[model samples]
Target chain A: MIGRLNHVAIAVPDLEAACAQYAGPLGAKVGAPQDLPEHGVTVVFIELPNTKIELLYPLGDASPIASFLEKSPAGGMHHICYEVPDILKARDQLISDGARVLGDGSAKIGAHGNPVLFLHPKDFQGCLIELEQV
Target chain B: MIGRLNHVAIAVPDLEAACAQYAGPLGAKVGAPQDLPEHGVTVVFIELPNTKIELLYPLGDASPIASFLEKSPAGGMHHICYEVPDILKARDQLISDGARVLGDGSAKIGAHGNPVLFLHPKDFQGCLIELEQV
Candidate 1:
C-alpha cells in the first residue's frame, strides 16, 4: 500500500525562518517557496539524501494550516506523506478498509504536481496522513 | 545533517487498535509491541518499503504520550525521527543553531537500540524532531 516516505510536512508560522534553519544549520538544500492556491499553502522543500521535508505556511484565511496554527501558535508537524505506486488502487483499498479520505474521495494534484489524498486524522490515530502517487 | 527518515511516530490511545488498522486495512507488516520503560511508552513499528511508522502508547500515567493523548484524545502525530550518521555532530550543530535538545541534551537508546536525541518542538516550528544515530 505505502511505498516510500515521500515527505514530512511541518507547518511554520514563519516560513522563511524555517527555511533558513534547515538551509543553514542542517546544511540542506532548500528550494524556492511555491504557493499552491488550491491547497491554500505556500511550501518550500528541503531536500535530503533519502527524503524531503516540506515547510508549509498558510496561504489564506481558508487554508487548513491557518486553523492548525491557531491551535498551535508556533506551528508543528502537520502531516506525514507516504508514496504509493497506484493512487486509485490505494484510495479504493483504504476506502474499503473504512478510512475516510479528506476531500471528495478523489485525488488532487499536490505541491509536487502528483496525485495526493489526505486521510482523516481520526482514522489514523489523530495523525493526518497523506498518500501521494509516485 | 539528517541521513534518512527513520520513522514517523503517532501517539495512539489504544495501541492494539492502531496496530490492527495498519496491519489489516493498510496491509502493513506490524511489528511486536516493545515497551521502553525509560521512555515511558510502548511502541510498535509498522514497516513500509522505505520507512517505518511507530505506533506509540502510554506505558504509564507518567508517559509523555499520556499528556499528548489528553489534549488529543483520539491520538495524533507524535514526532518524526530522522537518521543521522553522527548523533553527536548533529546535536552540536543543532544546538549551535539555537535548537534546544530535550532531556538533558544527551542521546538515549531508542527502540531500535540506536542513540537518539529529541529536539524541542518550539525550536523546530513546534515539531518534535528525533535524531537517531543510524
Candidate 2:
C-alpha cells in the first residue's frame, strides 16, 4: 500500500532553466543536478517542506523521458511517486486489483537509489505512477 | 515563497472511476466528491501522509479543466498547488522574476477556501502551478 507521497517528477526540456525557475521565482531549495545513467536521466530535486519536486532531463540515448519530452516539448509533469513499505506485496495487491505494472513487472533502481516500479498510466487515470520502496 | 506541496490536481474524465482507482488499486484514502460550482469542478481528495491528490471533474459548461480534458481524454495532471505563507508577496516575487501569473494576477478563493493564484504554464516549464495561502 502507498504510504507517503514521495515526489512529483517533472520532465523539463531545459534543466538549467527549470532549476533557475524553481530556485529563483519559486523560492525553493533546489539540489545540484545529479546524472543517473542507470535510469537514463539527470535529476535535480526541489526540496519542499513535506515532499520533493524532481526535475528530470533525458540522459542516455535511450532515456525513458525522451518520448515524454517529445510529446510535451516544453516538458510536463511526468509522474508522481508514492512510497510503499513492501514493494513486492504492494505489486501483488495492485495486480490482484487488476492494475497493470509497467516494464517486466520488476522493481528497478530509481533516481534516489530506491527500488521502484512504474504502473501503467491507463490504469491510473492517465497519470503515470511510480511506487518506491521506502 | 512556496512552502509545502499542498496537492497535485488531476483532471479525470470519469470521476467515479478515478476515485475507485485510487481507493482500490492505489490503496489511498479517498474522500467523497465535493462539488465546487463556483470553481466549475467536482473534486475527490486522496489524502496522503504529507500531501493530497485531488481528482477533478468538470462541474459546469465553463469548467477551466474542460479544454485540458478534451486534450487528454484519459485525464492527466492539471496543476500542482504549493502552499505559501503570503500569496500576494509570492505573486509579486514571481512577477518580479519574470513569471507570468494567470488571470488578472489577483488571488481568488481556491477549493480549500484559501487565497490562490495560478501561474502561466509557458513560464513554468509547461506545468501549471497554483499557489495557495495556507
Candidate 3:
C-alpha cells in the first residue's frame, strides 16, 4: 500500500555545499535541517512548492546513506517517501506482497519526528521507498 | 531549479495489473487512464491525497518505455516530474549547468496537453527528472 509522497530524498556529498548549490538556483531555501542519530545522518529539508526535497549526507563514511552514495556514484533523487496514516498496515501489506522491510517491523521517528520505515530497493525495482506515518 | 513535484511516474510491466495491485490495498482506485501516443504510454493516474501517482506502461514493445522496462527488472517508481510555470527557462538553466537535454529544446504538450520536457538522468545522478510546465 502507498500514500501521499511525503518527500523526495536527495543524497549529497556535503550538506552545506548541497544547500548552497540549491539555494540561489531553485529559489528554494527553506531549510529544516536536523540530525537523526539513530539513522546516522544529517538531513536538510528544503521546502519546495508542492513537495519537500530532503538533502541527506552521512555523519560518517561507514553509515548507510554514505554507502548508498558511494555505490550509486552520483547525487540525485534517492528515495520517494509516502505518508500513510497507518504505517503498520502499509508495511504489512507491502511485506505480504513480497516486499522486504529494511527495518524491523517497528518504525522509528524520522525527520520532524514522523515514524518512518524503509522498504528494500530490491523489492521495489531497485528504487528505495520510504513509508512515513503521520 | 526544482519545482513542485507534479507526479511521481511509476513504470510497470502492466498498467492494468499495477492499478489493480495498488487499488484495494492502498485504499486507492481513482483511475484517469489516458494514452500519450507521442511518449508511447498508457498512463493510469491514481489520485493520492497529497500527490498523483502515474502508472505508465508502453503502448508497444518497440517503445522507449518498453525498452526501459526490459533493461530494468521490476515495477516501481521511475521519474519524478516537477511542476514548473516555465519549462523553457528551467531547461535552459539546467542545460547551462551542463545537464543534457533528453528532449528537444521546445516543450511538447504531454498528457492533458501540459508542456513537458525530460532531463537526462546522467546529470542528476541516475534519476530521470521531468519538468512539467503548468
* Collision pairs in model 3: none
What value does the lDDT take at residue A79 in candidate 2? 95
Off by over 4 Å in 1: none
Model 3 spans > 4 angstroms off? A1-3, A14-17, A30-32, A93-99, A122-126
- Ranking of all predicted structures according to TM-score, beginning with the best and ending with the worst: 2, 1, 3
The 10 consecutive residues of candidate 2 chain A with the worst lDDT sum are A18-27
lDDT rank order: 2, 1, 3
Q: Tens digits of per-residue lDDT for model 3 on A1-134?
A: 56677888878776676677568544576585787878888899888776787888887546788787777666656788878888888888877777688856689888878889998866554567788998
**lDDT to native, each model:** 0.89, 0.92, 0.76
DockQ of 2: 0.84
Tens-place lDDT per residue, model 2, B1-134, is: 68999999999999998888788777789999999998899999999999999999999899987888898989888999999999999898888888899988899998899999999998888899999999
Q: Which candidate has the highest lDDT of all?
A: 2
Q: Write the per-residue lDDT of candidate 2 for residues A1-134, one digit (tens) a residue.
A: 68999999999999999998888778899999999998899999999999999999999999988988898999989999999998999999999988899989999998787899999989888899999999
What shift in Å separates residue B29 of candidate 3 from its native position after superposition?
A: 3.4
**Cα-based lDDT at residue A84, candidate 2:** 98
Model 1 - which docking category?
medium
Using DockQ as the measure, which candidate wins? Answer: 2
